[model samples]
Target chain A: DVKVTQSSRYLVKRTGEKVFLECVQDMDHENMFWYRQDPGLGLRLIYFSYDVKMKEKGDIPEGYSVSREKKERFSLILESASTNQTSMYLCASSPSKSTEAFFGQGTRLTVV
Target chain B: DQQVKQNSPSLSVQEGRISILNCDYTNSMFDYFLWYKKYPAEGPTFLISISSIKDKNEDGRFTVFLNKSAKHLSLHIVPSQPGDSAVYFCAAIGNTGFQKLVFGTGTRLLVSP
Candidate 1:
């Protein structure tokens, strides 16, 4: 079975703290993505990596950065947590651009 | 601006009945469409998909119908069970490879027995 695992299910961070959200896919897929889900806003892409060390910004990449040094791992970093940034962050992977994506359980982050 | 829209926020259906969820998109460049089901505290799961070339696609009890002219799509779940209750999101992808999908706000479905 294909699985995308996120490092945390819930997280709390101070307003000025820097936070990291890790994701690993065992499917060996080439494309990995990070999206933040909010009520009434749906899911907005943050960043995605098409290959190792290749990253692309999604619609909302402000105040965030990503790393993809390894093939199966992609990490989303919050440079500075803010209260408005609180939301459910999701990680997904797909074999290719035209394929359906498999998503992780998601991490609900609360920035105080 | 929201290119994809799920006008209905929620829908209720009886068990053994068909539940229909509708979605509309403003972008004509979108060529592929997908439907995802998400439960509370979990991520969205891919349900079904249809490309612009095909008007309909089916998987077991789930069916997705596309109307290219109107930029509309619908997901029909037959004999919906209580377990089918979840939030449904419709997504559209452009021709860009490594498809970056644009999603709707999602419609919550509740199936009652």
Candidate 2:
């Protein structure tokens, strides 16, 4: 079975603070993604990395950044956390573009 | 503009009955469709998928049907169980290998005993 693990299951941050969400996959998948899920907006992609040091912006990449220094780890960075940024963040990994993806237990973030 | 749409936000069905979930897309470029089931506080899990060339695909009690002309797809679960209750998301991917999928606002399905 494939295992995708997130650094934090829940997080609390203050406005204007920097926040980081980490994800690691044991399957050594080539593609990793970061998504933020809101109540009515669904899961919108924030960023994705196809390979180490290669990143691409998704539909909703504003105020967020990503790092993929290694194949097994991907990190999401919130430049300046705000109340509106509070939501559940999910990380997923896929071995190939056309294959099924495995996801980690999401991190529920609260910005006050 | 929500290229993919799941208009029904929620649905309820009795256990042992069939649960049908619908999804529609406006983008003609989308050639691959997938369904994912998500539980509260957990990431969505891959359920079923169908390609544009095929009209239907089945796995166990779950079946997926696609209508290319109407740009619609549906997921059917036979004999729905309490454990089947969850939020279902519909996603579409273009022909590109990058696999950037456009997802629809999910529908929450509840199975009653």
Candidate 3:
């Protein structure tokens, strides 16, 4: 089975603090993605990496950034946590664009 | 604007009834469409998918129907069970090969016994 793991399931931080949410996939997939899911808004893509060190901005990438240094790991970074940025973050990996993706359990972030 | 849209925000069905969830897309370039189911505090899981060329695809109790001309799709669940309650997201992808998927707002389905 394919597994995508998020380092933290829940996080709390003060506003203006820098936050790092880690994700790792064991499937050795070529594509990795970070998405933020909000109530009613559904899943909004933040960033996606097609290859090692290659990244593209998704629909919503304003307050966030991502890093894909290696094939099996992709990380999402919040430069400065804001109250409005509080939401559930999900990580996913897929073999290619046409294939189904495997997702991590997700990390709920709270900014105060 | 949302390229993919799920008009119904929520739907309720009794167990053993048929649950129909609808989705529409504005982009004509999309060649692949997929459905995902998500539970509270958990990430969205891939449920079923249908290619643009095919009209219907089935996997056990879950079936996906696609109409290329209307750019519409629907997911039908037969004999709905309590375990079927979750948020269903419809996503569309064009073969840009970059893997950028346009997703709908999602519809929450609740099955009651």
Candidate 4:
């Protein structure tokens, strides 16, 4: 079965603290993405990696950064957690030739 | 500006009724469109997709229609059930040779039994 796994399901962090969210995929997909879903904002892309060590900014990448050191693993970093950053973070992966992307279960992060 | 837009914020429907969700896009470079279903606290799942070459694509219970001229697409759910209640997102991918997706603000669907 194709699976995208997130390191944490929920996390609560203090303001100004640095946060890291990890994601891994079993499928050998070349493209990985990070997105945050809000009530009315839907899923806004934060960062995406097309290949190892290759990263690009999405629609929103102000306070977020991403790392793709390996083929299957991608990480999202928050420089300083804030209350507005509290939202459901989703990780998705897709093959370079395919448009269908598979997503992880998601991590609900709360910044206090 | 949002490349893709789902103007409706919410929709309610009775069980066994048909539910239609609309989406519009402004970018003409988008050659593929997709619909994703999301539940509270869970990640959005791929529901259906349509290519620019075709106007319609159908799965078991979901059908997606694309209108290239209008830069619009829609998802139709037949006999919607309570289980179908969730947030529906419309997404698009340009012909940029990569799978970078652009999504619109979602439409919350409520199917009451």
Question: Judged by lDDT, which candidate is best?
Answer: 4
- Off-target runs (Cα >4 Å) in candidate 4 are none
Candidate 2 residue A75 C-alpha distance from true site, Å: 0.4
Q: Candidate 2 on B1-113: residue-level lDDT in tens?
A: 89999999999999999999999999998899999999999989999999999999999999999999999999999989999999999999887778777789999999999
- What does candidate 1's lDDT look like per residue over B1-113, in tens digits? 99999999999999999999999999998999999999999989999999999999999999999999999999999979999999999999987655788889999999999
DockQ (0 to 1) for model 3: 0.71
Task: Identify the runs in model 1 with alpha carbons over 4 angstroms from their true place.
Answer: none
The residue-by-residue lDDT of candidate 4 on B5-90, one tens digit each, is 99999999999999999999999999999999999878889999999999999999899999999999999999899999999999
RMSD of 4: 0.9
lDDT of 3 by residue, B1-101 (tens): 88899999999999999999999999888999999999998888999999998999999999999999998999999989999999999998887766676
Q: What share of the true interface contacts does each candidate keep?
A: 0.73, 0.61, 0.68, 0.82
Over A32-61, each residue of candidate 1 has an lDDT whose tens digit, in order, gives 999999989898999998999999999999
Q: Flag clash pairs in model 4.
A: none
lDDT for residue B5 in candidate 3, whole number 0-100: 92
The window of 10 residues in a row where model 2 chain B has the poorest summed lDDT is: B93-102
Per-model TM-score versus the true fold: 0.97, 0.98, 0.98, 0.98
lDDT of 3 at A30: 95
- True lDDT of residue A82, candidate 2: 93
Global lDDT scores for all candidate models: 0.94, 0.93, 0.92, 0.95
